[model samples]
Target: MYGPVCFLAPAGVDDPQRPSGGNRYDLELMRELGELGYPVKLTPVTGAWPRPSGADGRELSRLLEALPEGSTALWDGLIACGVPDIVQAASRRLRQVVIVHLPLADETGLDPQVARELDQAERHALHAANATVATSRWTAAQLTEHHGLPGVRVHVAPPGVCLAPSAPGTPSGGRHLLSVASLTPRKGHATLFAALGALPRELPWQLKIAGAQPDAAYAAHLHSLIAEAGLTDRVSILGPLAGAELDAAYAWADLLVHSPEKEPWGMVVQEALACGLPVYASDVGGVPEALGHAYFPGETAFERPGRLLPAGDSAAWAEALNEWMCELRLRDRLRTLAEQRQRTLPTWRSTALEVAMALGGFPSTPWHTELEAAPLATS
Candidate 1:
């Protein structure tokens, strides 16, 4: 039997209308833990996370104070990392663990001072936790190196992919490139537009960007950029697709293009690969790992499921995109590799089991030993 486990996260984490990688991971983990017979309790805290108001901080303090001593509580790093005092106080009584989706400081467009402050706060918060869980090995390494969290046992529990049938790729006339990510600065929509704009106008390509407009200003900027580059007819911003719409977007696309400036385990990359869609992504945090590829110091090998380009490098992106469009053989080669890789992606159950083992404090069950001893599933 496993003891009661509390999962504390921001409100609306499981809202399908506002789909996000972090939210999906949290929701799936909680559901799978319950299915695995763990007494899982999800506590949604309402506030502007990572920078909560005074009232929000007080509410969080009250929530943590109400928990009984020796309770195992898993705190989402978004809330925990920003408020070190509350987490530190709760650590004295509760057995707290932190699930860091990505380091708070790594967020794009933050002022240097604010980033430094967040970095310091996160370092302090991780130290307060009994154990820490990172969504990727790159993130775990960042926590240890950038945050100086050498003592923390940071376990890697990457998000899992739901295996899907191979997508019937785009028909022969024009290439359809799909990019699935929220319209935020970190997602690098600007760079994507710039790269596509630099490509020849005669190239047979159409871009479908499917994601929520989290930042209205950025969305407006992207629209203006597209118009300025005379790409208004070529690009479409399909907002927040889900269920059939999202599935169809994946199926209809010839290629998946993700140009995030920083991505800790790009979940969409895995999802696209699961559907046998070739990926071309930015070589950022944990993205190469998800693509089942590696980067050597001085080699430009394109033998994997997809290719990785330097983050924010519009010229490099344009060059790669041009090659992909002009070379039918290269496209077919990537598609074949993507389909072969789809068979090896991990399921949500495996991800949940790894997370359960990371949380610890469970009674000795037969699966406990197996779970603890099991290796993390490769991409």
Candidate 2:
């Protein structure tokens, strides 16, 4: 059994208006930990994190100073990794355990110098932690190779998917494609639009993008691009959906098209598969792992449930979409594969249990020992 634990993350993790995979994971884990009888206290840090201002730094410092010396603090790497000084100081007092969704430096569209600085800061902060938890094996490897954190005890606890009824698929004479991710550069919305634009205009399909517009300028640009490509009628930008609304969207979708430049673990892919919706995603990061397939492009021997194309390859994405749409047999085969894979997904309870065990250094857990001994996924 673990002692009292403090969960620290960005301020808007619980905000329903801006739902994200990371936010959902943090909220669910905290709830599950509490349900499992762990005394978990959620402490949200409010600020423009990863690039916290002077005031944000002071506030974080105050919060850290007040925490009990022996307290186990599970810090979300978004805030903790970027603030090396603050985390390093807190590590000296608190038992710091960092939960990294993705490395800060890996975020797309960062200036080279800024990325380098973030990499350095994150490396320093992670080195100071008692242990580090990665959301995916790819991220764990990245921490070791890219951040120079070879000594840190890194634990891999992937995000779990909720079992849901299979989607009914496309309506008669209509095909629906769904892309679930935040409207950010990292998600590669522009790349998706470019790929969609290349597809035949007469194709009987509609694209629905469900995500929050965190970047207003980027959102506007997407809207403009849609109009310019004469895709305004074919596309609908549905703001972030949750609970029943999200479930309905998944149920209605024929295919899940994700074009993120990079993902630590694409939670939406698992979610899509759970709903029996075939995924056509960019082959990046831990996406292949989530799809239950290895990244073997151009290898006909590997029977992939869905097509995983090279990231940022608009022409390849267009070609894949064209083939999937025009060939009924291929679509049916992919959907069948998705349905088969859904049964093998891990539950949220298992994820929470793993984290709880990790917090306590995997005490008395044979499963944890086995997981540790298993070969880590390679890039």
Candidate 3:
């Protein structure tokens, strides 16, 4: 019998204004794991994670001590990676597993010294853990290269998508564009704005941005760019929408524009696909994996639901957008491909099962054991 899992997550994971892919993954996994018959003891830790205060460290240490000896402790990387000393101390008695959505050092705009310190801390913490789980194959590879962690110990548990009702796009399909990412430099909002501004004024397209303004300065910069380009009327910055509201936004959009400078895995991409909306995303990190490929039956030739552009290349983005706007044939083909792709998306149950099998090899469940040979879930 599998014992209860001590699941440690960062606080504010449910903040409507700052909903993140990592937070969503954690929440879904918790729910689905419970449904799959695992008792999850959840503890949402409060602090500036990955750089918490001394008191925060004390709180975490106390919490770790409170767990029963030899318990299976599953920690979100944000809560565990920054405190190597505490993690190493706790490792002696607990079977600790760290789930990394993204490496702490990989966040954009960090000072070199700070990045190095975080990297060192993460390396120590992950090394101290019994096993490490990454969200994508790319992220798993990065952990190995960045921290020299053993590939055998690192497992990939990619985020799953709940299929939504297919979007009913306009007849010509280039009227609405959606971007769902926090307003940060890392998300490449500046690049996306620049590309939009370069499009001809006569092109019929409006952009709806649904995300929180996490970085005030960057948010301000994006607003100024929009105004300077005389696009204030055409662009709407809706501060984070969820549930039915987010679903409505996806349904209204004809295309999803995701241009992150660096992404571990784009949950939004899969979400868009699930809704049968094509994507125009930066070809970086695990985005390609999330986007996957749409197979054409009876033909070996495959197509992606949308285009992948060079990261940070505003000119390339502009060119692609212009093509998408002008070519009805291209739009029709991509729309059909998007529908085809939607049928193949992984479900939350599968995601939770993969994670469960990784953390504790449920040998009695023969089907789950098959995932042990192929740890990374193919998109």
TM-scores for all candidates: the values are 0.91, 0.91, 0.94
- lDDT (Cα, tens digit) per residue for candidate 1, span 1-379: 7888889999988776688889988988898989998898999999998989999999999988888888888888999999998888887888877899989999999999999999899999988777677888788778867765542256677888888889997655139899999999999988889999999989989999998887788889889999998899999998998889999999988899999999999999999999988899999999988888422224466456889999999999999999999888888778878887787777889878767766773321222112333222211
Candidates 2 and 3, the one with greater TM-score: 3
Taking all chains together, the TM-score of candidate 1 against the true structure is 0.91
Q: Could you give candidate 2's per-residue lDDT for residues 245-317 as a string of tens digits?
A: 9999998899999999989999999999889788999999989888884222344454667888888888899
Which pairs clash in model 1?
none
lDDT of 2 at 308: 89
TM-score of 3: 0.94
User: Across residues 208-265, which tens digit of lDDT does each residue of candidate 3 receive?
Assistant: 9998887788888999999988899999999888998999999999999999999999
Comparing 1 and 2 on lDDT, the stronger one: 1
**Which one wins by TM-score: 1 or 3?**
3
Candidate 1's C-alpha runs over 4 A off are 294-302, 361-379
List residue ranges in candidate 2 displaced over 4 A: 171-174, 293-302, 363-379
- Candidate that would win on TM-score: 3
- Indicate whether candidate 2 or candidate 3 has the larger lDDT: 3
Order candidates by lDDT, high to low.
Answer: 3, 1, 2
